[model samples]
Target: MSIKKSPESWAPNADQDLGPVLILEPEEGKNFWQPQPANGHISVRISPDFLDVQTPFSLGTQTLPAGGYVREHSHPEHDEVLHFIRGTGKAVVDGEEHAIVPGKTIFVGRNRRHMFVNSSQDELHWVWFIQPNGLEHFFEEIGREMVVGGEDPTPFPRPENVLEIEARTAFAPQPADQRKPD
Candidate 1:
């Protein structure tokens, strides 16, 4: 099967003229990951900026290293769906733990705390979508851009104003008991 390109390409350039369509190779999208202690990264494939739409959703891919995890957190205004693509892991959502494997889809409703922990030796990969858009902006504020692909994974220093950013986005943090493994 072959995929057809859109009538107009929307890739950004210095000129900043908006195009009718945006065509992006996987690598062309903005890439970012949580700094240290968070354990994974994401490649944002589509967002409002990328699509030039007022839609309230964003799409991206994430990879979690073995033994790595995303700390428990919640989006007060958005719901999230995670579709596992590779490897094995576990998702803790709202105090319940569930296995994560290829083809499994996890739904995290708004204000429910959740996190993903990679358990297999291999990396756990998944595609994620969040409703009401704007999560991309949070990622951009909290993460540094991966300028080049396949670079060595290193800890990114936590930004001093992360709490402020999180507050602005209503990204509530879970309590320590809720976030830690039982």
Candidate 2:
């Protein structure tokens, strides 16, 4: 398989000539990975491929409409950093409450349970960053952001592959025999 490159893909040849790294606004029309809505909450401007190195990391802006609430969820394989840019909200991390507002940065560790609640009238604008490819492909597959208002969308980290035969033998309650053993 061949790796596809984007027009904005960094070129190694130009790395040397570029003197100093400068900050610039993200491309407005750049296409981004759209994840499936989890509940009733909506996530706009989802970009999960901002920067990838040893670990596939991403950074993107997000807006949680007024009264939007994210159901309890957890990231099993990656950590997340959220920087609130507009509006105000609160995050329940591992049962601890933390207020979220512009200039506030929250770090969520992998496998740590958390949820976001927006009580302010203004839409919440925040920059979210994830490490080690957190739901990047999954979001791309489903399309549109995952909006969950009343349901939990948390899922375990799925490794590349796991054979059913091995899973049955490895885990307790072997159902293979009850289902007409092969």
Task: Identify the leading candidate in terms of lDDT.
Answer: 1
lDDT of 2 by residue, 116-147 (tens): 77778877777777775444444333333343
Residue 65 in candidate 1 has what lDDT?
78
Which 10 consecutive positions of candidate 2 have the poorest summed lDDT? 173-182
TM-score of each: 0.81, 0.55
C-alpha lDDT of all candidate models, in order: 0.77, 0.52
> After TM-score superposition, what is the CA distance of residue 86 in candidate 2 from its true location, in Å?
0.3
For candidate 1, write residues 115-175 as lDDT tens digits. Answer: 8888789999999898877777877788767766467555666688877887776487646
Top candidate (TM-score):
1
Model 1 Cα shift for residue 87 (angstroms): 1.0
Which residue runs of candidate 2 sit more than 4 Å off their true CA positions? Answer: 1-54, 145-182
